[model samples]
Target: MSTPWTPTEFEQRLRAAGNERYHHRHPFNVRMHDGLLSPEELRVWIANRFYYQRNIPAKDALIVAKLDTRELRRAWIRRIHDHDGHDGDEGGIERWLRLGEAAGLERSALESGEGVLAGVRLAVDGYVNFVRLATPLEAVASSLTEVFAPDLMERRTAAFEEHYGWIDREGLRYFQVRPPQGRRDSREALDLVRRWATTRADQDRVLAALDFKFDVLWSLLDVVEHACAQK
Candidate 1:
């Protein structure tokens, strides 16, 4: 018979899965963070990634709706605000739009989502749907990709400044802002998962959820890289 998993083993497995499959290792991210992507490649990334930036709030809201406690709801709601902004004049989505504009994409094209690749749209939608349908604990685990985000964001910001001279600081605002925000959010989320996952079964589910999330992130980058390779 197969051996049952323990909480410690589950946690180790989760970390291993992230090490194996996180977007940090993806070719698209590697190229972008290493200052190797062309201006046209940067434009493609900004255009495709706009879909993900826009969907994050919706994903956060879905997770919020699944939570039973007001404290959890309140804590989670900040993510929506961080992405959507107050009065539509600030926040991550706006910063991403500025990046798109710097890449020469029209505002209409971004808002309409017409320029986004089909695979990118599917991957983003799959993530939101996974959060919507998953258990609250599983939903939180799915956000663990944020744990790796700070490093990726820092590298991306540095790469843009050093190699992509066409994109000024104003255009790379989203990358500059994401590291601290991602660290805070991911820490809170990891704490919640670690604290609440007391049972072996719960830990296994959390790990699986994290693995699924990594696949979602990896799939998005794979599609982007495939397209870039074709160009």
Candidate 2:
């Protein structure tokens, strides 16, 4: 029953959603990037985030499997490799583990995922299911969080290096490695979404999908902030 929309309008809406609700604006993220978080806080964040990191490759695989074109699949496969690595001692997952170790969390604790809050798991799973069921264009659009990631990464890296001396460059490898890859991956995905979303309805759906994805990211931070507040 809603009126139609233009692609520009859809893009504006997605940007507005990012401005309003993205984790970049979250106080936890601000405290984290600014190096104000205690060691315990960093450990909790690293542990909780392992759940999200583990699921990303699975979600990418699900999305890749849904693609009909080999070219698309080929591009999508990099995400899987980035997260899962060739032999498990490499890739983003391992880097995240190193981050956990740097934050003083045991390897067993991070891999166990026992510390993940219910809300965080639900938000991340919802994102995965949404991407799997949505159109490919919408799926790609949902990843527009990458558009904001590089800036966040830069700020976070500076904050850690300047304010938090507990972690050094080696300990922060996850943040160090992600921004460039995120920029490339996000640009490619955004281009694909923009090109394939030909109709107003499709464009609107893509924007909504991105908004939903932002909510997923925001919800993770919210859960963390709430847990911090409760303690």
Candidate 3:
């Protein structure tokens, strides 16, 4: 049986999960950052990624439903607002639509999720379903992927500015805003898991949740690449 890990060891293992499996290592994302994708390929990826972006708040809502404490709910609800926006404020979803336009995709089609691949849709839905069925701890733990996200977001924004110069600068706002936001969010999630997942089994479950999210992101990229290949 696996022995309970020290708090520091457990945290290291969690970070290792992202180091090994985060989608920044996915071939499509590597190509994106390398500036190798055609405009069509970029559009394909953006259209599909918009699905994942919009679903974040949905999955977050599922997590919110599982939380009983007003404190937990109050804190968790910010993720939803971060994506969906408060009144008079635009959010990540709108920022993503701007990216779609920058990529030369029709705003209406991107907003409606038209041209999103079959596999991409399934992958995003699986994430929402996973959170719905998971324990509150597991649901929150899955979001620990944010611990690894800021680097990718930063790299992507820089790549856009340097390599894909044709895209409107305004569309880069989503990527620009994400790094600091991701860092803040990841600290909250990592703290939650570090405090709550004290037992071996609980820590294992948290690790599994992070791994599951990694696969979801990888699957989305795989489908995006495949869809682009067929065109």
Q: Pick the candidate with the highest TM-score.
A: 3
Error of 1 at 74 (Å): 0.8
Kindly list the per-residue Cα lDDT of model 3 for residues 1-231, writing each as its tens digit.
778999999989888878989998999999999999888888888888899999999999999999888998998899898899889769889889988888788999988878888999999999999999999889999999999999999999989898998899998999998888899889988888888897899999999998899999999998888878888
Clashes of each: 0, 0, 0
Best-to-worst order by lDDT is 3, 1, 2
Off by over 4 Å in 1: 1-13, 87-89
Per-residue lDDT tens digits for candidate 2, residues 179-221, read: 9999899878777876777776777787788878878988998
**Residue 146 of model 1: what lDDT?**
89
Per-residue lDDT over 113-144 for candidate 1, one digit per residue giving the tens place of the 0 to 100 score: 98689999999999898998898899999998
- C-alpha TM-scores of all predictions: 0.92, 0.91, 0.97
CA lDDT, candidate 1, residue 21: 79
Better of 1 and 3 by TM-score: 3
Q: Which candidate, 1 or 3, would have the higher lDDT against the true structure?
A: 3
In candidate 2 the C-alpha lDDT for residue 100 amounts to 82
User: What is the Cα-based TM-score of model 1?
Assistant: 0.92
